[model samples]
Target: MAIDWKGVFPAVTTKFGEDDQLDFPLFEKNLQFQLDAGVNGIILGGTLGESSVLSLEEKGTLVKFAVEKVAGKVPVILNIAEGATRDAIELARLAEEWGAKGLMMLPPMRYKSDHRETVEYFRATAKSTSLPIMIYNNPVDYKIEVTLEMFAELADLENIQAVKESTRDLTNVTRMRNLFGDRFKILCGVDTIAMEQLLMGADGWVAGLVCAFPAETVAIYKLTKTGRLAEALEIYRWFMPLLELDIHPKLVQYIKLAEERAGVGSEAVRAPRLTLIGEERERLISLIDGAIAKRPVLPEYHSIVV
Candidate 1:
């Protein structure tokens, strides 16, 4: 598939049944919402998807389900994050076999590899599969930063096509564009800084909160791309509070609550990840409720100007 690697590509949460099984029905509903909202692509088994908790079999099921559900309307990209190099390679190959159009892979998981080791991990995974790869550069949570020099080193790999820039440093976006000049596609990975990064020439968005608020997320991207900053800012400011939820430690619970409030998916999560309860739950619900009550009526999307 020819991926433009630009626009909204939501990092959706993996819906789970009360029994902690993969909830295919709700998952499909969420994907449909994203597709209907006109997002550019769908990324499955991401951090927001709670990929670390999912088993290999469950991941395979998700890949196949997303591919079949999307039916080529948009690309279905699978995220690969493993502590070992070989495991990552195996997952990448599995994604390809299951018809994923692209791979969004992180550096070695759990173990924080140095620059050299990290680059090798990504490069080895890239070599082991034919799938185009988006290197996830999230220094904040992952603790391993893929610096400009590291990216420059990995630049020779043809399948290593794009990046999910979540370094949280806005200047990194500028530096990437300045250095690569679109040689490598850049997607904003942090929700809080999404609008700032997009305006600074981020090619796309690998959004987290979009799983709950799809339209508002898409609207921010579309309005910004169409040179309608005033309009985009209107939604961004209203959406900012929810966007901040994406970066929280309990992001899964927070986002699922938002998803429930937004009428997309259930708040059920796997064990070790409890459903939000009591005052904690109440506060989040209040945030979502307040936003819902005052939600802005977004203008229609225009043909992307940039």
Candidate 2:
């Protein structure tokens, strides 16, 4: 289950029951649904996965569950979003012990670390485990940008191999390619700009809305990779409205609601992040319903592989 670091990797949301417990059946069903749609990897405990609210033991359970359910068919990556360096290192080590094939790591969770601290944090964590790491570089949200110089400093760390490119500057993709060659595999993190990033030489997408619209997301990626630009754009235009939902502050609730409406997921979110209500709910429902009512016919994309 080596991570080639290509294709659609969904930042899947953690499913929950009315009782607020982890709903294993629902989780597995959605996970299997994503896999069946031809996604390349599964990312557990990411922002969408509610990593902040999950207990240490809960995170371990998810890794074990995803690993077992995925059955080594694809790489299951556990996201480590710890605030402390020591804790991040411990979690990285535990991920390997729990059978995680790879890791997607964010910078120090609550604190906005400076360049040196950020590099050190990633350096220390990546050095801790044998698991291949995809550095989550979303400065817009996480507030810590892994600058090119910082990446160069970490270049010698073989385990810190790939990046979830969320800087929102698409040209940074070319910058990385020009600077390091392929030393770092780049996966587009923003759903809205995915096709653009892919068209510009991104290796893959660490997608958000794909949690709900798995098949469409994969279709876009496969279509682009296969050079079916016209077909890809057709779907991408239709998917744009849905993809915009991923950038909101309440992205978890927004995407979960999309999932619920799509009949592949539920709307139950953890506390401090309640489900959408009022105009927000109405607006999203209308959007999701309209998209479903007008769901585009996907051309056969399975033949095209990345």
Judging by TM-score against the true structure, name the best candidate: 2
Which one wins on lDDT? Answer: 2
Q: Provide the lowest-lDDT 10-residue window in model 1.
A: 297-306
lDDT of each: 0.90, 0.93
Tell me how far the alpha carbon of residue 93 in candidate 1 is from the true structure, in angstroms, after superposition.
Answer: 0.8
Per residue, candidate 1 scores C-alpha lDDT tens digits across 1-306 of 978899899998999988888989999999999999888899988888899899999989998998999999999999988999999988888888988999998888889899889989988889898888989998889899999999999999998999999999999988998898988999999999999999899988999889988888888998887788999999999999989998999998899989999999889988788999999999999999999999999887744555
Model 2 agreement with the true structure over 240-300: per-residue lDDT tens digits: 9999999999899999999999888999999999988899799999999999999999998
TM of each candidate vs. truth: 0.98, 0.99
